[model samples]
Target: MSAPTPQPTALTLHQASRVLEVGFDDGAVFRIPFELMRVYSPSAEVQGHGPGQETLQTGKRDVGISQIELVGHYAVQPSFTDGHDTGLFTWGLLYKLGSEQAELWSRYEQRLAEAGVTRDTPMPAKTGGACASH
Candidate 1:
């Protein structure tokens, strides 16, 4: 098997609009939105560890990123205002999202529609979780 690729050392996060501007060492850049990140979280709490265990995320339409904490040297943990930070987005995962953002976003929207969930609002302030460990 081939060796794993390296993570980007030049990661920029713009917290104003809750977006992550990730730049790779190879001159690649991707801007990820908070909504997208929350909806596609890889955590078991959000994505679940097994099949048929996915928990659909909703009411994050207006959620903004509170912080982007780097976990070690490989992944980033984004903390959302809605109190979600379980998903640790690794370099490879970020690259995948950057490459297929459009397709992934479309798929997510479709799936949400099929599930009858609408991310149209933010959760109450009391509802919070470990979205970032920094």
Candidate 2:
């Protein structure tokens, strides 16, 4: 007989820490970083609709989860601070991501380097009004 599929028993988003804690029925608990989740989003915007069309996500090193909503009984949709809310993070995918975080993160970094992108660079501050006189 095959083992039963694991399901999430609890999900918590730590905004300050920028981490998502997921506890599974199989006694596995994973703390996934917000940046990792953002870059690895399962949305077509990142993964595309077919093979070899995956887009490399960058500039999300400081991203955070703004919201998490249940999608039926199979998945949760996380709305990112970067305005990404289309990925459906299924239990299976979440488990895989958690289990392979180190390797996946390494690959992501490599891809960013190849693309001449660096997460260390911060976004420029927005300025309003040019030298307004008081």
Candidate 3:
């Protein structure tokens, strides 16, 4: 027998501009901004496993992406300025994070507050990606 395809209850693109509003079957909606997602990629260029290992990204608060290339059907390849062109985003991880965006965002905000880190003044750019916004 053919496997059942997981169907989403609600999924539609916003007609406003260049944004996508994704909704899951669980009545959860996540409106992810394109610029935000681009800046906060979770590749090795941004996150390096532990504290003091992360690379702070700069010039990305309002910076939009030049392009988003899909790396197969499961993940997407994101490129950035300052010549950063690595990092792969899988569909599973995206879905998981998008599902818990609200809670995760709050926790991230709290952590940043504790660290006295502001999104406006991002730390010096390093080797890893910038805190994996996706």
Model 1 spans > 4 angstroms off = 121-134
Q: Who wins the TM-score comparison?
A: 2
- Lowest lDDT block of 10, candidate 3: 3-12
lDDT of 3: 0.55
Candidate 2's residue-wise lDDT over 1-134, tens digit each? 97655899999999999999999999999999988888889987778677877877767888988899999989999999988898999998888888899999989889878878786655345356522343
**How do the candidates rank by lDDT, highest first?**
2, 1, 3
Off by over 4 Å in 2: 1-3, 121-134
lDDT of each: 0.78, 0.85, 0.55
Error of 2 at 52 (Å): 1.4
The TM-scores of all predictions, comma-separated, are 0.81, 0.85, 0.60
User: How much lDDT does candidate 2 score?
Assistant: 0.85
Off by over 4 Å in 3: 1-29, 35-40, 49-52, 56-59, 81-83, 125-134
Residue 74, candidate 3: Cα error in Å is 1.0
Q: Total clashing residue pairs per candidate?
A: 2, 0, 7
